[model samples]
Target: MPDIAPQPGVVEALGQIVGARYVIGPGHDQEPYTTDWRGRYHGRAEAVVKPADAEEVAAVVRFCAENGIAVVPQGGNTGMCGAATPSPSGRSVVLRLDRLNRIRWTSRLGDAIAVDAGCILADVQRAAEAVDRLFPLSLGAEGSCQVGGNLSTNAGGTAVLRYGTMRELCLGLEVVLPDGRLLDLMTALRKDSTGYDVKGMFVGAEGTLGIITGAVLKLFPRPRASAVAMAMAEEPEQVLDLLALARTRLGDRLSSFEVMSRRQVEVIAQHMPDVVIPFGLESGWYALVEISDTLAGDALPPMLEAVLGEALEAGLVGDAIVASSEAQAAGLWRIRHSVSESSKAHGYVVSHDSVVPLEKQAEFIRAVEAAIIAAEPSATVVMHGHVGDGNIHVLGILDPARFASAEALRARAAEISLAVDGVLAPLGGAISAEHGIGVSNRERLRRVANPIELELMRHFKAVLDPQGLMNPGKVLPDALPA
Candidate 1:
């Protein structure tokens, strides 16, 4: 909580751009914009400006820039960290883009769709499906999360195994810079060897660089036929072996591959009745494999059967179950999605969205789990994530007995993360993975980020926002002021 002076004429200036009715400030109506999704960081904004379109957003940014006011571009406010929240000093304006919700169009030839920043992810998926296309970005927050936040974070969901993250799915973006200049880099074409590729920069910037207003996203032919198989393994290490064998056998047919721990599975089973574990026998770790095809033919079952047979013979998978019906496939996916909610229901936990190189995934998981358990045995460790992409989400729960003083446990968990990240550094893995380096992970960035890269990031931020008017305490480390 550093000191930040309130900029003059902030309310009047923004009120002139977007009507005063849409501008929220210093009142009960503005409370929600002052905090983050997790309720971890509570910020204070001079005003919350809801812009109806890209032009309105541009105007608001222009007014703020002229007055030397800071701006925090927010979407659905569904981010885990306080990346989208404003500062507590009340010097910044919260520019919410929810009013700009729109689906422009879908391109058949290029297999891409244009969407406004405020468009809900689930709605985008439905729009894509209307054109007989599949928007492969599937996450727990799809129903409520806005496309802008997802694009800003370069969100990676279950489908990252085949389709890739938001960075890979995004073709172009329309961004408004800190100085109020708009850069429309919306190229629907896939093969573009253009200069610099500026759109890619804003994808994972976490709104520190600029505000992402809209995007052209990659889409695929809707999967006409698909099969889901739940494979149980005696050990977490065997999940990697299972993935290796499936990748070889399934080839391009693989759609989704996720790994879940026993505790993670049990939590989902207990909380969500609709989502039952496909297999009754309890295993240490499990793999959820999805094989799909675009054409209207049921080739998924046979291919899955062949792969599972090989996996069983190789002693890689302990047990397996291929969903005989579509309802069953949805049930399995439901179980996978419930992991986060169930953990939250239990209590406070230290979550890490870390990733290692694919070949080193199992080894990384084993070493990190052992180290963490050894250090904090009473902690309920719920481990799971997009194993196909090597991103392992490790959640360390606090001891129920030590309910009143959880701060000590949280500090110890962070120390464990530092050690785990240290082990992952040599493998060229990211400590933050798909989740951007918000205020929460800023210090961790300092620890893990290369010094040269850190310097360059600071230099870039200075060049774009010389006065530090954009999201000030994000992405970059706070200790080293730019």
Candidate 2:
């Protein structure tokens, strides 16, 4: 799609809200806002507006609201689902909130932080660590992804096994309503029973409801001592059993239980040689376990050793390696973190982020693999994810030579995604576990989500965004009734 021509005096009105320098358009300066990080989604904005704070954001939004222009609120733009990208229609304006980056308040005793939505996640973590606290949201994109996008997508990362997703980590929020009103709910209160869970409505709404301006995030005490273990297992059941043992033995200390296929390990080995993977390629599966100790003493390593030793007796562990030093532990984590990058390097892949009931995960993977292979025999599955939380990425990597063009590959991607959903739906899993239903999974969401629930979601969308101007054509299959 081509860039939309500017509405008469529209750019001038937006410039008046923030500034002419902030309201930029019509050339090379606007190129950066037109595409996503992955380069898969390309869009064109009428104008890119940089707002510094909620009031400024509201004024910009107010102009878009009055003029019937679509406003796409973007922060960092590190999303995989194209949620932050502008529309292909080129009529919308991009609202960049990066300038609002600020750590408003941090309370060590309260274990809470109030930050602007545009604050980078790693910056928040640094602020917490500076005070001997921990902000437990960690992901590959933490260095670049903004807090607002994390909360908007309810992102789940490696630490989700311990700290939970962004939704659970947040206490309150300050949002700019769709119609340009500021809703200030960024409070430090942990418990509020007065009304509905108002903050949750916008948590995973993908900015369709409003623009998240600021947030109150939960923090934790920093772990004083930690242990990391990488063990080989023959089957998913053995991995599950080993995880059960770790949870029972370590209890609250268990931080992450990541499962990766042997193929994932090989891909990482092939791509990243410096990172040490514990087990050899003899086994088809491996589990990466971590224990975070809050106490001053370093007891976690011995405890993890004891647990893995028990798993060995039970035949749940084939081969194992426990990190003796922090550098070694970081190396093991590097292996786990390299999974997605390695998979992307493999080939054209249709990735899934589905989560089933904990016990049903193995069966779900088996069923989906069986179904996919029966239909498309040449498909290869690369698996890795939070095994403790029942979320597994069952990516189907397609051969480049199979299809003649990119469009054909995408068509095949759609079919493969539906096949995954076929198995996932019957098992009561989500089409999107951590990634919200942006343009990527909105169709699947429409297909599988409860009709009544969808109707209510649309109702809420209409109520919050009466003009249907806030990130139109995202999260919902269709626009609210005009």
Candidate 3:
């Protein structure tokens, strides 16, 4: 595909907006900014613009709006899909938000923090913890990802079962509208029954509506004491039974419940040698569960022992091991964190982050496996996810030695995704669960999203970003000409 060029004057116009030092055009300066994390998509951009503050961002957007040039907002570029990268056509400018990084204000009194869009997620977590609070939205890319990207995607992580997604954790936002107007509505208040709750329209809009400058995030009290356990299960079904038992016994204290298949465990053990497993025995599936002690000086050992005992007697759990100390707990988490890295070691794979209703969680995983096997007899499917929220990361593995062509493997994976979508259609599940619908899943969104909901989305985008200059070709399908 040929690169898309903008009007002859777009580059010069942008240069005037943010100054020459901040604006980078084609050549060595722009080469490093062209690719994404997964190496799935690559495209050239006319220039990479770094705006230091909201004013510069607004100026750039206004210039693009006036010149009819499309703008693609990019932060950290840690997104799985090519949502952050410019399209193959080298016409658009990549508006990089890394320079906007800053910690504006944080309140220990009400458990809220205000941070710039470019602030790294890990930094935010540390800042919150410094004040004896927790910012629990965690993922594999937390170290490099930014708050803007999280809010834009409404990211969900292991803590979502307890703290909720980024949407729930967020209390306010400050955005730069498409036409260069600033929407300064960053109120860190909890209750405001004022009007339409307009701030929400851009929360998960995936940068289609506007460029998010900063946000106020809700925080929670840090867990006093934490316990981690690993349990073996006969199948995914047994895992569900174990969850019911744990919930009934542990109540709201359950912090994490991650389910992994035997295939996932085998790969992790093989690829990541540093991560140690307590037992040598194998099982059909496994769950790495965690609970937090809310009360001060509370004894967590007895509570954990009681739940494991009941799980064993009922045959819902096969075998279990609780972490003896904090060091052991970190080791268990390392195993869970290495899942994606292990899959990469196997060969080319297609990763899907989707969520089904909790009640049908086990059935959903089984159906995906069966459906993929039925569709492609040679395909190998490995499943792992935050089972507490019914969100599974289904990976289709293809041995590079057997299938030398990466393109062929990706094609097969896309077919499997289509089949998975067919299964999820009736269940009202999400195609892009934690990962937002970037350029990769835009078409799928059109196919699976409810029509009325999509209409509302389109109308809102049209109103806020009428010029279509904010992250064009993302979150929404290309607009049809009248």
Compare the candidates by TM-score and give the number of the best one: 2
Model 2 pairs in collision: none
139-257 per-residue lDDT for model 2 (tens digits): 77788889999999999998898889999999999999988899999888988899899999999999999999999999999999999989998888899999889988888899999
- Give the Å error, residue 101, model 2: 0.7
Question: What would the per-residue lDDT of candidate 3 be over residues 1-482, giving only the tens digit for each residue?
Answer: 54445457666777787777888876556666778877777877777899899999988888777766677888888888777887777767789889888888888898999999999999999999988888999888889899999999999888887889999999999999888899998999999999988889888888888899999999888888888899998878889888888888988889889988888888888888888977654788889899996576547767887899898998988799898889998988888888888888876677778788887777778888888887677666888999888898888776655655877666777787888888777776888878888888877788899899988888887778776667777777665211
Write down the TM-score for model 3.
0.94
Candidate 3 ranges with C-alpha deviation above 4 Å: 1-16, 400-407, 478-482
The TM-scores, one per candidate, come to 0.94, 0.96, 0.94
Order the candidates by lDDT, highest first. 2, 1, 3
Q: For candidate 2, which ten residues in a row score worst on lDDT?
A: 473-482
In candidate 3, the residue pairs with backbone N, CA or C atoms under 3 Å apart (3 or more residues apart, or in different chains) clash, namely: 3-89, 3-90, 4-89, 4-90, 4-91
Better of 2 and 3 by TM-score: 2
Superior candidate under lDDT, 2 versus 3: 2
Query: Poorest 10 consecutive residues of model 3 by lDDT?
Result: 473-482
